[model samples]
Target: MANPHSDHPAHLQHHFVSSEQQFDAAKMGMWLFLVTEILLFSGMFVAYIVYRTWHPEVFAKSAELLNPFLGGLNTIVLLASSFTVALGIHYAQKDNKKGLVINLVLTFLFALTFLVVKYFEYTAKFEHGVFPGAAFDPHGVSHGVDYATYNIPYARQFFSIYFVMTGIHGFHVLVGMGLFTWITIRALKGEFSSAYYTPVENCGLYWHLVDIIWIFLFPLLYLI
Candidate 1:
């Protein structure tokens, strides 16, 4: 921690001249990292579009085996978690530690809810043998829905794509939960304030990216 400023903040690193500079630099870095994440997912999206274009029926039919209700529920949970993260950042900016801590905890809980819902969704899919690649073998029927009926040609490709795309997205959600947990602990320790809440802000941006990715994922994997 090198400090040139006689009034330099403790959190401000030695390399940065001012807190504003550090904040801007961090934000720019986060955006750049997010761009990489977008590119990473974009390749998968392109693959999906190409495959779907080649076999629209296969994709549509394969989608039937998916539980849109669970997907929609997880979407709502992630959106709410993003909102909570935003609120946490707002409270941090206002120097309201209690508000910030509460919101961070809430955000963590929402993230946990998302993962829990996703767990059930994954388990149900597994129960039906709806796995990726060669392992795919949709079978059985608990209700009126027959999983065996969904075993169409190129359907394996659709499930593979579904698992890959959603699987990566789910991994991000898990990471976000970890991030929120760490941030919540820091918030409780009173490490953040208006003068320096960069971690809180950065974590919020990452969570927003996670939610945005899922927004694209839900429609591509579930509805359409």
Candidate 2:
């Protein structure tokens, strides 16, 4: 007799001979997607490094103004979320539906917290006349003695890149939040099982890619 487990309804896929074949194909596709994403972010990182090198004094000054504490806290939040996402995938593979749901929810919460902190950081900058591009105005540049020492234009350039880079990164976080929400809904509905959770697994891979980007961004933008 055919193995009962092999007869799972999830075993059928229009383009594959078995669920295993479909799972492997999906995993491969997701990895390829992540590779492209890395290349996209690499362009931005290169631009940032080049500009910073060209204006080291300004870059260092801007870095000083950034609250390392907020950046550090967000970093910890993302790392913890990544851990929960990993556990969620592990439990999903084991067909532990409840555990998967719980972990996914925790991941969503962390993402929300990250955005909340980011909002305050951006708002504070704006209030200090740290707007990007032409809107930027250093109130002290015209009055303070220190302004007579450091070049002002260079400072504006640093803030411009800072806003653009972090703004783009924050957009990615929003995308990840949407993905988590979709996967959580499906998991709660019992749409995933040990036999066919490749979609969930693939989504987890995407989330991991986002987390990895933040890892590089943190040190590059804030620490150095």
Candidate 3:
């Protein structure tokens, strides 16, 4: 019997039975990648739980030094970026190239804003002598804030977890920005449309996953 999808678009691989099949396959692959990401972070979360359990007081006190205001601002920025990406996908589906491009640019800008805020937060920590591992030393005054007061037993554990988690999250944000830039270039060249937007859709899914990770990290590292 002749294949029903033999006339599928160029973007649809010849091996795929249909466009829907290809799309589903791509989505499934993306979900698998997201699952691996979760598993990777799960190890850090377990370490955090164990250390926090052993030194709840230290964890609480150390967390106090972190700026919840900046964390909250980053959370808002990420969420807004997620919304913009969703809007970009919607515009792509509607064949509105201008809307899609605008939303993607907005999303990229939001991601950049989040990273900039994180830079200052990290610098503030470093200036206060809040280093992780053996270099862990909170002494002297920096940025008009004294770190010696935060020198509690096992406080290093808390800062270690903070740096590792936030560092990984920041790396993911950088990657997302690069992905958005590539997509934005493609978007400018009229590469995506209602008929084919797999790249944009996949990128959106990845960005959402990154944002979700931050949602979890914020409360665990900043609030709690």
Candidate 4:
């Protein structure tokens, strides 16, 4: 009798004993990456806590300048994108290439929409002189709102953390978009199937993480 493992897929590496092993290894690696990501974000979260503790009023007042409506809309967009990525992985596991492709495309579009909204938000902030650090100067009527009122002490800290955290999250969104684009093209070319869909699964995991980060961000930076 021939070895059943002899017909392993082309993408399988020689080091992996079986496709199951390869998938497990990929998942382990992703988890490790996620751990590092969590640690990285944890430092920023700690900073936010420390500053907010010291200057709660400033932080609260500064947060009012942020448009919660836009933030909520972006939150919805990211949540929807997370759902589409999950659906993509489901279709990939079911060997439904067309469904996978469609979901991936939708996920990318949702991500793009999020960034577009963010672009407008950032532009409004810049126009209002809501910059970080020593350049922090809110003086002028932009968006028909006077930003000079927001020029409270330590308010820069809040905006700085807001920008850094959300900026990093947005960067992840862009990265997820690239990953989905690659996976979508592969799906269109019949690269994924029930037998070999590790890429889709891994990318879905990444997309979900990005969405999760934004979920945390929306409330911390907008609602709370």
Q: Highest lDDT, which number?
A: 3
- TM-scores, one per candidate: 0.96, 0.89, 0.94, 0.95
Q: For residues 189-215, could you state the per-residue lDDT of candidate 4 as single tens digits?
A: 998889899889888888888888888
- For candidate 4, the lDDT comes to 0.89
Better of 2 and 3 by lDDT: 3
In TM-score terms, candidate 3 sits at 0.94
Q: At residue 207, what lDDT does model 3 achieve?
A: 97
Question: What is the C-alpha RMSD, rounded to one decimal, of candidate 2?
Answer: 3.9
Q: Which candidate, 1 or 2, would have the higher lDDT against the true structure? A: 1
**Candidate 1 on 1-224: residue-level lDDT in tens?**
47455676789889888899999999999999999999999999999999999999889888877789888998988888888889888999999999999998899888889888888888998998989989999999977998998888999999899889988988988898888889888888899999999989988998999899999989888998
- Residue 26 in model 4: shift from native, Å? 0.6
Task: Please list the residue runs of candidate 1 whose C-alpha ends up more than 4 Å from where it truly belongs after superposition.
Answer: 1-6
lDDT of 3 by residue, 47-81 (tens): 99999899988898898888999999999999999
- Each prediction's Cα RMSD? 1.9, 3.9, 2.6, 2.2
- Predictions in order: lDDT: 0.90, 0.83, 0.92, 0.89
Worst 10 residues of 3 by lDDT: 1-10
Backbone clash pairs for candidate 4 read none
lDDT of 2 by residue, 85-198 (tens): 999989998999999999999999999999999999888677667788887774444222333233376777777877887887889889889999999999999998888888
TM-score-better candidate, 3 vs 4: 4
Give lDDT: candidate 3, residue 38. Answer: 91
